[model samples]
Target: MLPINRAVSRGLFAGLALKAGSSTDVAWARACYAIRFQSTSTHLTDASNRIRRRRKKPAFLDRTPFPPSPEEAVNNILYNTPNATPAPVTRHVLNCLVSNEPGVLSHVSGILAGRGFNIESLVVAKTEVPDLSRMTIVLNGQNVVIEQAKKQLEDMVPVWAVLDYTHGRIVERELLLAKVSTVPHEHLSEFVEHEIEGQEVEEPESRTSFSPLLGTALQRQAITELARLFGARVVDVSLDGVILELSAKPDRVDAFLKLLKPYGIVEAARSGAMAMPRSPVDGVFEDEASLEVEDDSGKVDATMLPPG
Candidate 1:
């Protein structure tokens, strides 16, 4: 079909030819129509070619390789370095002071979870200031990972401050409560004798009647002595078991648990570590400005920390 402009032009030219009444005029009209049609067709063809070119992919795309998958890309960037060895992971203790509000713990934990970190132990409780709370987090990670975690935690709105006491001379302690069997194990007999430092008394035939009671008394004595050596106390005593309580450093708590293992620990609970830096002087507290400066420097003043 002819375009409107072409149809109108054709009609006008034909009318002129009829008025002129000459074969030359008619042929001229036909020639002009053909020229217009050819030009239109050429213009339409060029436009269609341009559209097709625009739709085609770029030449570089054909030569360029597809991007690596997310997992592969991460591996290449983080793990595929030349002569790179894995960073050594060590335990880190981070103390965060946060506002005492609901869901604060969940928010902090969610951040760590999103970053793919596992919290070994977490202890949260109200600080001396009623409006603020202290959260102690224990985790094992490379130094870089821990530092990144600290930065992220510090960025949180509820987190007022983050203190890393892993390398600092802080007084850290954990509480352990273990329910151990009152009946002593045979293996612990030698240990008991060594710890108690008293020889057993031989009894006559008539006195042998009290042997069972004597054995029970000796067992209690052994347990009590072990507790005293570790600065623990027997908090509860029952016919079958005794609850021992110990508040000490994490390593000492572990050692105490190991010592009680032979006696059949029925149940045990340990409060995750809580820590504070030693006071520089008696009854004097370090202010927030000094704490901030220490945090920025990543070092605790040796003079501020009391020597052992």
Candidate 2:
């Protein structure tokens, strides 16, 4: 039997010849058919070579062994890859004391947003002073940019003070509440009560014997112990889960959550970071050198300005 390609070519050329109306056209079709068959083997050879080239291993791969060393394998995988190191940006915490009025939060957030500054966490609430509110904002940015942002915040109409507490000695804390699952593993089987001759028989406790209720109790105990270790309180408990509350520094809170993950955390919520300067002297601003008003008589009244 003729090859499929050759058979199709012969049929195609025969059709062309039959369709030719003139003798010259028929002769031209015959010559074209001869040329096509003559070049078929060369074209097939070139296509086969192309396929083999594509199937061959890349030049870099050929230099490495079948099972490359760990380091070399990693290098090969990451060859010509871009550096994955992140930009140098540090978290900055700013505490702004602003007027307690409507649109204050919106105005403050808008200023940050307009400048392309992302507020990672913002906690705003009424301050000790009745007319003032404190906004604790956490964001990541370069030091210079954060400093400029602080200046802008201080210049706002409603803002009374802007404190950059990122580098200062301050007490920072975050609150976390997590619900952890208390369900026991399915593999634990409860003790089975059997009957023999109408008499109730209980299976004796053994290595294989495990009660789901007991397992659940043990799991709760473990959770309680972990909470105690992390200084977390068991706020609420249910048949299926228990809620834990923790107030600690951000890192400590993260560590506690990491340890609680084994107990199957169902849900979690965090109150963003709240911070205050550790020293009373830190927040106080220096008094201006000149507070006296200049008058035609050059009379100075020290009482005009309040005592610093």
Candidate 3:
């Protein structure tokens, strides 16, 4: 028993001594090396896993209503007009000839604001005759909402005429004024070269003229011709002028200016479009001048329009 107990004690003590030594410098060195090695391996594994997960996840645009396929994403921006369906933002211009009464303008504007039509711009000026005034208003909304707004304006007592300039065969124009920054060689050349981005030229020509594209009775033919011959772009076409914001090549726009030299150019500005539909009836408003409104409740009256 004594021998056995001694053997057990010796073994236990030796094991303890070994364990104690292991916890000191030698054990500490091994422990540190093991931890460092494991840490490096763990980090590398974690990084590889993260890369794989990222590769599997979809892009930000994939969550949209209409996700662009591989082909669409490559060719067009994900948020381009064609890719993104536009909400119903129908634009309209309204031309009115109202009696120059004190509260007439207020009533017209109030009707629009009350019904929640977003008026982009409103201009009111007295006509050549002191008793009458001309008002131009731009607004946007749903087609139904606009129709309701128009009906409300026409129903008002003082409104002589409320013409939806959108359809009228009249000259319409919107002015754009932009004070773009110009620092020497900074963005000046880029800014000077292009204000709006979408421009492509077919052929180069030498020309410098600012001719207002005339919107005459035969303007459709002229526009078609111009588009065919010079590859002129029709930015917008209204009764007034066919807005040709040259998107062709730089040399092409320059050549267009040369071709337009013989024709006179009107005002030019930088920005999006602001146009009004104009008609040749501007000079012959005598019959329209004498138009008398007979209010037929709950119905649109056409006797108010300018006669040709």
Candidate 4:
């Protein structure tokens, strides 16, 4: 893991020192080579330190300088006491800033696959800014694996930053689009969509009057009431029934689905949890910036915006 310059100098020193010569001549030659290598290695190490100090800082919480020399990282690990036990496996969400180009994703994904890491979920999309894309990956592994993945990602020329969201406080969310075959048309409540708009799930929603003229008004009204309870909204209604959309924690979504099963679930799509580290302030969702993105296709991809 020596720097390239140091490695080259060592190789030259070894080659020069191995040459046959008279006893005195050999001693002088070895001494000269040793001195030369030392000087070269020192200069190279200093240059490496300068480069590392100038390495772009990741937006992540850690501000530690990138390793000045790869050898130093190895030495640190070799001399450091090992943890009592290998870190237990845990889920981690990693966000990587990468140049928008072909094969970058394949290169990154290949590295993890080669290392036998399991990627539970992965999302790749352009960011709000131009050219730079964000790769959000969810993996389950020990702390050591996570560290290896981050280092590997940082090594790639196209990667600008790799932030381990799980290691720090973060704002996390998941989205779900579920289609159910039942529309609570029984209750004459006009519709739940009107109520779902412009409201946070936490805030109380006043009951909209059910349309008395609608058939099965009471049943439909009850269904609308329950949908509101589960923080669901009718995104679309047609012959297939109703499309309910919601965003919440995974477990909450599970509960919501379980309750809606009697309504006949036709299909569902969920965006695996996306996360970003919280700011220095409190963990309030409002304290963080949203990650809404729109590509050249004119399609808005809402990974995780502020939940309201």
List clashing residue pairs in candidate 1.
none
The TM-score measured for candidate 1 stands at: 0.57
Q: Give the per-residue lDDT of model 3 (tens digit) for 196-279.
A: 564422222434521122223244454446555865455665433455554443345456655543333444443222344534
96: Cα error in model 1, Å: 0.4
Worst 10 residues of 4 by lDDT: 286-295
Runs in model 1 deviating more than 4 A are 1-82, 185-213, 281-308
lDDT of 4 by residue, 141-207 (tens): 8888779878988999999999888867777777889877544534313334444474322322544
Better model by TM-score: candidate 2 vs candidate 3: 2
- For every candidate in turn, the CA RMSD to the true structure comes to 19.9, 23.9, 24.5, 33.7
Q: After TM-score superposition, what is the CA distance of residue 240 in candidate 4 from its true location, in Å?
A: 4.8
**lDDT computed for candidate 2:** 0.79
- TM values, all candidates: 0.57, 0.56, 0.34, 0.50
Per-prediction count of colliding residue pairs? Answer: 0, 0, 20, 12
Please write out the lDDT profile of model 2 over residues 214-254, one tens digit for every residue.
Answer: 56678899999999998999999986679999999989998
> Candidate 4, residue 85: CA error in Å?
6.6
Q: Evaluate model 4: give its lDDT.
A: 0.72
Candidate 2 error regions (>4 Å): 1-87, 185-207, 280-308
Q: Give each model's whole-structure lDDT.
A: 0.81, 0.79, 0.58, 0.72
